[model samples]
Target: MNLTPADTEVTGKPASRAKRPAKSAPGAATSAANAAPTTTPPVTSSPLATPTLTAGVASVTHLTEKLAEYMSPSDLKKVKEAYRFSDEMHLGQVRKSGEPYISHPIAVAEICSDWKLDAQAIMAALLHDVMEDQDVKKDELIERFGAPVAHLVDGLSKLEKIEFQSQIEAQAENFRKMLLAMASDVRVILIKLADRLHNMRTLDVMAPAKKRRIASETMEVYVPIAHRLGLNNIYRELQDLSFAHLYPLRYHVLAKAVKAARGNRREVVKKILEAVKNTLAMAEIDAEVYGREKTLYGIYKKMRSKHLTFSQVLDVYGFRVVVDSFPNCYVALGTLHSLYKPMPGKFKDYIAIRKLNGYQSLHTTLIGPYGTPVEFQIRTQEMHRTAESGVAAHWLYKTGDTNMSDLQQRTHSWLQSLLDIQQQTGDSAEFLEHVKVDLYPDSVYVFTPKSKIISLPRGATPIDFAYAIHTGIGDHTVSVTINGEAAQLRSELRNGDIVEIVTDPASRPSPSWLSFVRTGKARSAIRHHLRTINLPESIVLGRQLLTQALAAAHLEPDLPETLIERLLNESSAKSLDELYADIGIGKRMAALVARHIYGLMGGESAAMPVDHANAAELDPVTICGSEGVSVQLAQCCLPIPGDQIIGQLRRDQGLLVHTLDCTVAKRQKQKEPDRWIPVKWGSDINRRFDSRIKLLINNEKGILARVAAEIGESDANIVFVGMDEDAEHVLHQLRFTIQVKDRVHLAGLLRNVRRVAGVNRVLRERS
Candidate 1:
């Protein structure tokens, strides 16, 4: 398997660009230049300095020097110790590029140093691969570098053996574990990110399929995470590199497009930068101004998503202005607008309203020289540092060597938030799903009644906002008032909208909210509440299921606890507690549990019901049996009490009950006869069942309203309704999930459905 990096992209042309009047700011061309760092320490030539260091014996002296700019001697010593340990452990191993494996760790540490990470993070980076690739141990690491650094390194290690059913599942699980570990300590994530970046840089050595898989995962998982953490520099580079590997043709095309745009925008960029530089100088603002080009991935993403040609994708160029102070950032913004025509409605002040990751900047798009559109971001030196280094910048920017309580609080809040999400969500797939959604870069900023601004992911409705504000507000949300107007509680929020949530004591989370809510926290909280509320009922159902299963096996319901415990021990369960917990969580099949419990209680081949009166009735109305298949018709397909039916013995799956006339049954019988079983509807069955009906109504605005009314009149719940269309008809598939005592009740409901206006076909689905 291979792992690569991913990139990011800008979405749209400036909305206000369409309303701009052409204007050109006259100025000399600015030099094609890169900005210099505000403070630079002297560099020392390395022994292996062919430019970069050599393998195995390469000194981390440069990394140490860089660290010294950000850390103390004690911390520096700790980092050196870690580097030395990694070097010894990787003494003989080598990378595909023929560099010693120790060089890889040194390189990873160097990347982290570029982020200006704290001593612990850098130390962890230097030792990240030791446990994974060598015989070195975590205990050894702890002894050398202390518990925290060792713990961070251990957290960053990939599982040694992944016994997943498929490669995708294995990779996904590995990513899940990585994210979970990262949630506990942000440093683990930083080290992992550095590791991934280095791996991506070496991905060309891997095979093509592996390259694509790794690159896709990087795009889908890691890059979004980096973006969420405000590590946009890494985020963007990862995206670009991954795209280059995963879609080289597209990457080159987009790169050329951006390069060509840069060449064409040369005069515009030069004039814009000169005008801004001169304006800032006149305003006596000490600032650094640099031009920024959109990454190739950004251009490709815009072209692919918007179905636009390369030239049609605007906003491909921008500039970054870094000032010495927060006040000077606004001054620079003012200077920029004065020098160029400001595009109306194309300004955002992120400094006043910071992002979830604490990113702060003033963003604007202007009609620059030659009427070309350009985006500009203005920020202070500190904001620039944070923008590049993200959480790592906190270590360097603190004054007087003060404690990191405030920084720790903010970082810990973000970390603990992930753990909270994990606790509420049991399914790894669902947890990852929520994390992906939460990591989307598009954001919507809203305000509370007290005027405190909060940002949430775009498309986030008020329910998400409620949870973001406080869990109590989310759990008890009854209604909401958006900007003084009563609004539906699920209303989508907009930028700068003031929202007030209304709660009721009796209000509780609904499963339906999962369909509309967007944030991970809100989704997890709602699901957790629902899970808790349903647990007692589920446990009761489980008990009934267990008791009925025991009766089927000719065993007593209340067998001795000692016998059950002995049976569980014989099974794989370490103790009864594990068995019961599994049963409670639906992980252990109730039927299986009952069978094991009954077998331990003297069940025999001869069947008998200990309590004949309490034996569950084999109701013909609910339980359909065909050819010993014991096919209970799926309520979804609804083979009625008298309906002819067939059973599909699904592979590693439950028998699927279907009517004899069901097309699905016919297809399955044709393909796999040995898997098929006969089924019949039980005579005494009395449970309510659901079957779908279709209506071909003329496509009209209110056709859905009439059909819904008819279903309501029939006393049926509209469990689901889906609409498909053709030129000839608006095909509506309506699933009336209703209670039916028997075949007669179903027939009557079908007849009633047939009478509804525009109802075309009310036939039951074939088994």
Candidate 2:
């Protein structure tokens, strides 16, 4: 955002536009990508002069006077109408700082004007809060200002009328709404950013908690967005402001340090700036050179992350060299490099490969006049504008400017991705999570086999790369070859590594992939696919469990559909599918659900309320570890067919299956007995269960063969094998996971193994 109308509220969108996020797929040509848009804070105070207008007050007052540079006469008149309408709607309202609420909108409008936004955007900024704070209708605005302007205001308004489960859900929902609007007409985001900038600047009057919360949110979400949008000036100010609000002491201390550094190094900075200018002038390069200080927040981040003190954070000063044309940018860089040695590996040609945010510059750290490192950013004036304003630069430079095309495309692609992620993850919270993952500022630019630059977060892996290319490839990936070398699926991608994901139709995404995948999209896609693939099987299992529980409640199979609906409603589930899915996943005890349904049906003693808090009274479910996301087969117990089993509901992890005699289960039961659910083997246990046993075998050549043959003879396959080696021992200690029917089959296998020619003794292992 830009400078405030007074000093109270800072306004103006960043001058730069983030790179247009384009689809990066193998065989697709190069491009750039990246953030979101906001809300009305409590009425705020600012030093700007307010237009005094009373209710029913007619004004031949202001129109285009402030925006004369950007607005036409006709558009200015219409903007006046919008201002009049909005002012009246918020007539008696006052902000937290005791400012007339009307003054707030005008201040926001001023910020938009500074961005050189169109009259429609300026007018929308004036009325953005009216719809939410007052009873103004969308249709009424359309009638007065035309659909385009109405739409912009509507996009900026928070959906306060809609109920949200949490504050975060509400915030995310608002962003979703705003992004959708901004995607269609980028002006909406510009106006929203202006509003945020104004509010943040005048945030001094708010309560400590609210101030901290807003400031933290601004730092985490908005500041980066400003950076991504290339609103460097606003981005920097917002970052400093948010830092000041969130950590007042740190902000003041850091501010002083930067100030002191500037004073101490003023001579060095002046020397560097003059020397660079002289060199460029010597080379006959037309450029403007000036010294620039790094933002306070950036310096603080470096200090904290790199464990550096104030004085140790070198490169705190830099120079911006803005040239008239693109070619002169290169010429200026050459001239500067000739004057001072460029720091090895401290050079980047963003001009050749723009940042994901569409930032283009020739960045090089140099040995400056004082022998201390100084950063130099060389770019054309146009690039400089986009670098500062980011997405907002699109309006400043115009759509037809070739420099803005990459940014526009990147913005469009990123917006489309938000829509796609929203569609993929129906829940606002989850979508926000995915949004957070993609919002990480640091990204590694990797190349696909076909040389397409696929960008991912710094710690992204092959799975993230594969998914970034296509979900199908990530899901079915069988192998990966990075830079002509075969690598693990979890290999971290490095900058410039050529990654080729080898996928197979026969392969499937493993549950383990959830642990290593770094990208939110990949995580969501995997989770969604797992949910999609598992829900049907889960539902089937859930239905079977319910049927058994209903029978226990003395209910018949031909029960009325109305009763099922009632049960679903009682469970607070949207559908029977959801209800079953819940039960299948182990969220609700089948027996407990049955009891509730029975009580609803007025069964004998059903008149008595069921106390689910004492769920231990409920009959346990039949053990089948197939319930997706709900039930997990305990790795410790490794219960197979015929094992005495029990189920326990663990928070967030679903239902866990354990052997009745498992020491882990016993310990848990002793600690939280209410969680224990009775479980037994099902009638048709068709699936294989892995049962492990330890054996003491004579160290004979054919002992391994004998043990394997004996297990095969018992009709149980050896799923795994391990041996504990001891040089002094003549007997080999072996462990095996064998598939079996149940305890009965496992007991039979144990006997068969004990009778093996070289096997001396065998015992069942305890979990």
Candidate 3:
């Protein structure tokens, strides 16, 4: 019987694939591929009677033969069995390119075999689509193949059953699932990459829009993943293929230009190759030197990022020297430098400090004949293998080599980080965002106090460094120092800086840290900590707000369980604390909540008249400046103790205390008067508050020093200092943010600063 058209509608599969009937019951033999043959059946009389079918069978036979080289006979037999099951499940399905559906999985399997993966991984690759397209359950695969293969196949499958709110959410959730699975078994991602690579190789049949979308995903996600895993070959190929589909015109133009450039630069390349080979020979170094050209996508990226034209993109032609030993790598680099004039500041020794992905090479740029810039990379043979295959080198070599073990460890560390981020992030979309942030390839290497090297993304701050060291240290970081000098927590780290993080038992993550942290682990940890603490803090503030509102209405702070339950029911809150949190976070106004409670208490609302008395008459919520995130002093006014302050209940932000006359608080009061509440300084305030004072001084050196000395003499610590020049007046306007105990302390400090010589004027600056 001919295959029907009902089974070819999968998302990534080609549309022209001939469909088959609906999937049969589990464990049932459906096609001649799966049926037990009593004897050798004639090809023409069998179900595979077409020419394409004969070719497909021959391809499988060839694949089985190839597997025998690396796999045991029993393992090879199992692989053949998996192919048969896959063929039966995909019976009569053909691709848009007119290839049988089974060809896709077989191709994926072949790719994995090239990596010399174990038989289970190869089997999972062969049967990857059966569970995805044919409704073959994971348990059924387990019953047939085993749990390991089943798990890999299941990890490869997408979340088709559960629905998502949007396509983006669905895609993000799918990525999250796959990444988590990869953390459990790195083989899953390896096989998944193989599947994607094969699909990308055959993506021509897809529509333009689908091509662009898939290509964009491959570039944005898979390419970086490949690079991160040290799969240089796959990484480069995926980048080029994605570029071809995403920007076809540019890809073609660049490809043609590169082809022409190659011919034109052939003589230069030949000269460099000969010179390098001669130099190595004279040095008695046994090294293999080969010429190489930059990938089209790499060239394109360089051009766009550096704003350079194709002609200006020098160093596109390069050479790789594979040495016999690691030490010879440096010897080769020195030999190349001697043969050509080395470009200034164009040498890097990745051999001394390996990349986060375990890539090691010594790179140098030199001025060649006719002023052409040529690049060169030198590495050992084993390093070359790892550079090309990355984590796959662990399996490809499989000799328990130290380098391979190190590569595997690095890959697993990155995978473990993915799990850590996933645990802290609750939303699939947010988890994807954090992971993408971590995937950036640009990195800066820093050192710890103990001289331990730590790699972080460029623009990473000390907070990111702390988090990279350990989550607990990040959570409790109170101060930091760079190169033995105290530094700001938000300061961007540079290469080779010795970062030291000091922690306190009471120190906790600050919400402001979220603005500067560059690592996913730091961001996720901060967000998770905030989420964990916010609810309870909100409930406490909500209780205080509701109690204040209740006091205004002549009611007791405590209510009976029945009354509280009624309020919870009426507000649709899960509990009293939830209702309190809602009110505290301004999700529900405390006044309205109190009014509802009054009604429940059988009080006459008409008689209450909503207490519009003077705020001075009502009891105020006290602030000690250590109320955690539930209470924050407004930065605009920097309200200290003894200032007339008012609290604004902000949605999801708890209570923000501001000076009564602060411009921001005045504006917010006019807009949402109901959210404003009375607040006052506590009787026993113990911490310092930040206050800013501006000084206009003569433009003389040492003027800043005199002012700083005065502030120090007054026992006021300057937290930050900013300066601007007033050319017209020949003066420097210096603004200092200092910490003081209260308004009284700040006034005294201002007096002391006014006595400094060269000081023109000093005033407390307020927004």
Name the candidate, 1 or 3, with the larger lDDT value.
Answer: 3
Please write out the lDDT profile of model 1 over residues 315-343, one tens digit for every residue: 77788988998888887888788888899
Q: In angstroms, how far off is 13's CA in candidate 2?
A: 24
Rank all candidate structures by their TM-score, best first, as comma-separated numbers. Answer: 2, 3, 1
> What are the per-residue Cα lDDT tens digits for candidate 3 across 204-283?
77779777877788888888988888888778877888888889899889888887987899998898888889889999
Per-candidate Cα lDDT values, in order, are: 0.66, 0.71, 0.80
Taking all chains together, each candidate's TM-score versus the true structure is 0.70, 0.76, 0.75
The Cα error of candidate 3 at residue 656, in Å, is 7.4
User: In model 2, which regions exceed 4 Å deviation?
Assistant: 1-63, 164-168, 327-331, 395-404, 505-509, 540-574, 582-614, 625-767
* Steric collisions counted per model: 22, 39, 2
The best candidate by lDDT is 3
TM-score of candidate 1 against the unseen true structure: 0.70
lDDT of 2 by residue, 1-767 (tens): 11111112222112231222232341222111001112222122211211222322222233245677667888887777676666556554555555555666776787677667787788888888767656578898889888988888888776767765456666777776776676677787677767777777767776777677777777776766666567776677777778888888997888777777778988887777777778888888888888877777788899999999998988888788899999888888778888899999999999987888889999998887758998889899889878867787675323344654778877766666666666666465566677777776788899987899987888999999998888788889999999999999988888899999888998877656767888877877876665566677657656766776666556664557888777666555788887776666555666677777777677753453445454345455666545445467777888776677887865323467888888888988899775566777667767777878999887879888888988999999888999985698788899988888777888888888898887888998767
